[model samples]
Target: MFASNPSKRRQMILLVIITFNIISTWLHYTDNALFLSQYPGPEWFTSVGVISAVVVMTPVGLLGYWFYSKGIFWLAYLLLGLYSITSVSSPGHYFFPMVTPISWKMHSLIWLDGIMGVLLIGFLLWSSVVLKEWRSTSVGN
Candidate 1:
């Protein structure tokens, strides 16, 4: 029902992106032992890292969903736009071109985060124009 509105196509695109984000976050944190191995045992951090991630990301995804579904597409898109930029920008080293696929294999998280960031940004820019046209035409009719 949320996606049925012509002006809300951006919401559909973002739903896909956010869903993938949630899945990726879950996959990255699923193995507790592996996650713990990556960090020094702070006891508290080791116990709480995965739970914290779920707590934080879930509400964000849900809020985005709610905003878009309610036709407040711009608000949802704005939040996600900010998120995507930060995710991609966080790894400062990867901004320059990397000429080889073989070399690319080593930095999976950086690549995934960066790529998702690009996708989200691209979609937002495109959908802004689309929603604008739709609003103008819908209002005219």
Candidate 2:
């Protein structure tokens, strides 16, 4: 169960959403790495390179959550926003040519990743608005 307090509830919801976004991103990157042939972007885009990005990005998302849990909203927002940027870019792959025909599996993951990124951004915006209202009321008191 989540707390009834708006701030706590918002934080809890954001945390769950953030975690799901992270997982969705990982799945997308893994799919890209494992099936690089479907992705016809560049010669440099090797499976190793793709997975290495996953290695680097995961920690950033985790750190964002850590900072969020520590009440550091700005840093958390920055880190989380940065982390979500990749997922937001996942759909961009459609703009490029594919070596082989793209399958529904890849398409679904790409959309899911992008949607998760959007959800994270929406939750962050909601959290900010809630925080602003909470601050204003406390300051008035």
Candidate 3:
């Protein structure tokens, strides 16, 4: 169905990547909770809160893709950007403290989430530019 529209194709790819990023976040958080890391957040930022964050953010990314598929570009852009923020912020874990060494699994999860976020942000910016050009040229025709 999306073969005809390049934007749709790009959005689909982004959706998949972001989904993985979300999963990485979930895994990292679950690991963190299990190991009892000093997560830099509120006192309530326990396992439940970690779960809640993923639960809340997952819908935002999905809804963004849904909106994009329906051609609601403005809202889709907003939600997708918000979703990207969640992933990009994963590196904030490094800024606080380094009391004890983290396992390789946790390190991998954290970097994976952050790297995916960077990819998502890059794609979003490129997509916006393509969209603007596509619109202008279409309007001219």
Candidate 4:
């Protein structure tokens, strides 16, 4: 459905961003920290972190599929973009502990997560422009 529109380029970009966000979110919850120091937060906070990640990421996944099927590419892009920003900022509570650990694996995961966050933010900004254009055209017609 996205093949016909000028926004297709942005749609493709957003799709990549959303796919990465979903994968990163899943990996973040599944990966094991090799050291206690690499733990994302206090001992008591890990479960909360997992749950929070699930809550946020699940909707993005679902909405992403909806956008694909309905051709609402801008909405998908916007949601995923917002999701990325929120994921990055909300986890600040845990990021420090996770990265400071002695294990290389944990450090790698932290780096990956940081990259995903940056990509998501970039996609969000680009999607916003596409969304604005879509809105203007829809309203004018």
Candidate 5:
């Protein structure tokens, strides 16, 4: 439904971001133990937690994608951009199961989120510029 190559590229970028967020949320639950603690959990609670995380996170991710696509992007950008900035402030491990003790996974997550925020801002500005040019070019015709 996009009219130009830039529009198509924007849509594709958005789709990729949406998909990445969804998958990240899923993987965050890890090892089917709901965050996959460095230690084991109680039997009933562990089962319940995993089931609950899957049930909740799938729809939650989809809903977030829907909101980002249909709602005011500035709102999402404001909240998520703030979050991205805050997340990178502390890069080391914080009592969680990271791939490495140095916390590269955590750092990568923050960096990826920050990059996404930057991309969103860029896309919004690019869209406005494209629209303005189109309007200016078409006005006399």
Candidate 6:
């Protein structure tokens, strides 16, 4: 019945985000593989997909740990912000449907990406404000 501490809440949020991002990225890879089976994209496209996925997921996962440790929330926020923005924009056009008449199955992913982007951006902005306050308080002390 006791209220959770703010840091604990933040840790929970970070964990949730990291889990969601990992699952989403894995699903994207699965979808890509299936799509490629029928219609293989250029080699460069696949390479880019693999590289970008690594780049985005690695930092996100690391940042979540950082958040849990209460060590670098600002950096985590920045990384999440970048990931969210890129996800929304279809970074590297990796999310673009490979086949014509895109199946209904993929729709959920598109929507998820969009929603996560907005949420992450909002979280990032809120964290930035918190960071500013923390900095000011420390400076004052």
The candidate that achieves the highest lDDT relative to the unseen native structure:
2
For all the candidates, what are their Cα RMSDs to the real structure?
7.0, 3.5, 3.8, 4.7, 8.0, 4.8
By descending TM-score, how would the candidates be arranged? Answer: 2, 3, 6, 4, 1, 5
Candidate 5 residue pairs in backbone clash: none
Superposed Cα deviation of residue 1, candidate 1 (Å):
12
Candidate 5 residue lDDT tens string, 57-126: 4554445344445444445344443433222222222433444343455445545544554554464455
Q: List ranges where model 5 is wrong by over 4 Å.
A: 1-8, 30-45, 71-93, 96-141
lDDT of 1 by residue, 16-97 (tens): 8877765544543443335444432234545366557555656765675576566566676666665565345524434444
Q: How well does candidate 1 match the true structure in TM-score terms?
A: 0.55
**Lowest lDDT block of 10, candidate 4:** 132-141
**Candidate 6 per-residue C-alpha lDDT over 1-141 given as tens digits, one digit per residue, 9 for 90 to 100:** 114455556556656765676566556555655564433345555645755665666576566456434545555566666566534643333444464554555555545655565666665566567544234322211
Clashes of each: 0, 0, 0, 0, 0, 0
The better-scoring model by TM-score among 1 and 5 is: 1
Question: Where is model 4 more than 4 Å wrong at Cα?
Answer: 1-4, 32-38, 48-52, 64-78, 90-100, 129-131, 134-141
* Regions more than 4 Å wrong, model 2: 129-141
lDDT of 2: 0.79
Better by TM-score, candidate 5 or 4: 4
Candidate with best TM-score: 2
Q: What's the lDDT of the predicted structure labeled candidate 5?
A: 0.44
- C-alpha TM-score for every candidate: 0.55, 0.86, 0.80, 0.64, 0.41, 0.65
C-alpha RMSD between model 3 and the true structure? 3.8
Residue pairs with colliding backbones in model 2 are none
Indicate the worst ten consecutive residues by lDDT in candidate 2: 132-141
